[model samples]
Target: MTVVEADGSFVEPFVTKNLYINSGETYSVLVKADQNSSRNYWITTNAIKAHHDFVQAPPPISDRVIVLLNTQNLINGYPHWSGNNRSLSLPHTPYLIALKYNVTEAFDQNPPPDTNDIESYDIYDVSENKNAISSNSIYRIGFNTTVDFILQNANTVKPNHSETHTWHMHGQEFWILGYGSGKFDKVHDTKSYNLINPIMRNTVPLYPYGWTALRFRADNPGVWLFHCHIEFHFYMGMGIVFEAGLEKVGTLPTSIMGCGKTKDMIRP
Candidate 1:
């Protein structure tokens, strides 16, 4: 049996029996949703619970590129790094958040929304990394180097925990830029954020309940993973892909036209 909201977004409703809640008992409940199906469900002691507020969908993962963000346990004391039943081999980034993406439309102009976006977290850098990309080709870090992303808060009942959210990347280091806490704006664009001096690093922090911008070069080519560092948040589905150093393949003269980048690493 499952509990569901009146609107039917989640699987289960808010009744006492529907939500496996023990009054006065402070216990952590593991909330879950279906990764493949539209029916969102959570696991409980008595049965597999469902709710209407939550949506069951697969988190976003871009095969063309790889993105990894550490959301859930950013602090040094989290179990992902210190406890016996450790969750991660590497230290979680400064912040973590849940996210989702469509396999087909992930790179499209408009994307779907999840509960985590109601308030976004982000960070940016402007300093360029000299060794960010190793390549034989000559590409300057002038206009060719820039990175930015946006987050949408579609949830009405945003989580009431920390007001700050941080985001970080993996593999190639990037420069910090600027960030905001609203929808995409054209006038206040972050395309040329810190066009002056740029910092370099693989990880950047995104603020809670807001959006962030960044700039980097597509110098490295390979499959790099980008997702929320928070194991729980990552499991919740906040991730993306970045494909740099991709080599473009030519098509035959017959008509089987095709174009793609080489999946090889390029360092300057």
Candidate 2:
């Protein structure tokens, strides 16, 4: 995906690599459990986020939010599925976290502190209703030459007697920024991702009712699909496409990248 500036001009440095955080910047953090589960995930360090919790007084500044993998665990909930036989005492570490910063939370205008010591929530209180504090996994991909893209998943969901839902994206890979419930907070604006890297494929499991966030560049000019890959969920409209770079791709005859077959595009 290509990263463009506010005025439609392309940002070179940002589009060079999947740089998770911009250079010379740091964000304060706090940890909290998902809504019901005592399993604590990092919320915000200084302020309040709708679906996440924090251990420190997060500075009032706004930027892309990240989950602290060091502080997540499964302490208070029963095993999601007994047949699977993963340790009940173990917290199912998350692969990706859904982000809820843009259009949901309000952004702050101050620069953040360089170094901050944040506390974590009680491990014992981690509950099932809460966002699962993910012991996150990180993957690095190189775009082309100058920039590299980093990505991960942070949220998960286990509905009562339901199959685990894996959220995946098509044509573009994104960074698992953060996870939360309710509408996304409209604060943290979209982060610029470097696209001068290799292409990537990704999938993240979501906690039922939990939302995850992704950071990627809109460099690829295609109608990309972001949805639950459960197939059933997708047919039911759990899928939404991110339309980027459509203008440059000019309107080809409906025969190309269209929903209809050749016969449909042409009238008899």
Candidate 3:
């Protein structure tokens, strides 16, 4: 069977019953159904290091977000992975990345601190803010631009409890730069980024209360979905979209044109 890397690259074919799939990661494997002809085989999945109960000291203010002054110095000339704000609410609406046809806009190359710089707080701290998660939240990038995203897992609502998330992206495969425990230290972590021969994959796993970094160029012209691979988490709103190169996206096919308010635009 062949395994797909985070950057959409193919790995040498191999075989294994035990597969590790992260929250947002997707895999395409080939299986030969050459088992016993009389009996059916059972397929199953289990989570390793699924539970955590270790309490960690709060992160220092300075460590909440680690900004990269020279993104160009990085392997792909993209921003580094900064941490995320530990919030449960749906951060924004779906389809926020859908761009109007023929619209051209320049997005800032500088890494934004919205997700990276925000500190994780106890869920109780902001429980009263009904709209803590903004519906208008969106991240836009220029076409063919390389981007680096750092996914950080923090303690869940339960004390001493952290969970694993499979981060997956649509439309493009990214290189798994690196993974580390605790908060992401730019200086220390950047030293370990795999610039050469890194596995290309669409989905990567993040250790509990740890961090994983990835990089990819947004060459595909469309609004792509990037989100946690876990179904329950996705249902609970753990995903976002990347709108890239809208001006280059010429037109929508009639098959995808009719829906909601656009029903009138459907072709016969």
Question: Pick by TM-score: which candidate is best?
Answer: 3
Better of 1 and 3 by TM-score: 3
Clashes of each: 83, 73, 18
Ranking by lDDT: 3, 1, 2
TM-score of each: 0.36, 0.32, 0.57
lDDT of each: 0.34, 0.34, 0.54
Task: Rank the candidate models, highest TM-score first.
Answer: 3, 1, 2
Candidate 3 ranges with C-alpha deviation above 4 Å:
1-98, 101-114, 118-131, 134-136, 264-268
Model 1 misplaced stretches (Cα beyond 4 Å): 1-147, 151-164, 189-192, 246-268
lDDT of each residue in 1-268, candidate 3, tens digit only:
4454443767666777678887777777776788888998887887766534432221112122222110101113321111233222232222422245321222222233435332433322221212222122346777876677777665543356666778788998877778887777767887888775567789998777677877777789877867778886654545555578778866566556444334444545
Tens-digit lDDT track of model 2 for 224-245: 5555677754543343333354
Provide the lDDT at 53 for model 3.
Answer: 45
1-268: candidate 1 lDDT, tens digit per residue: 3344433244433334344454333332233453778666654565345553443221121112111222333233321211111122221211111011112221222222212222132322211211111111111112223444443221111233223333455656555555555443435654435555555555655554354555555455433455456555444334443444333222213222121111111212
lDDT of 3 at 108: 24
Strongest candidate by lDDT: 3
Worst 10-residue lDDT window, candidate 1: 93-102
Superposed by TM-score, candidate 1 places the C-alpha of residue 77 at a distance from the truth, in angstroms, of 31
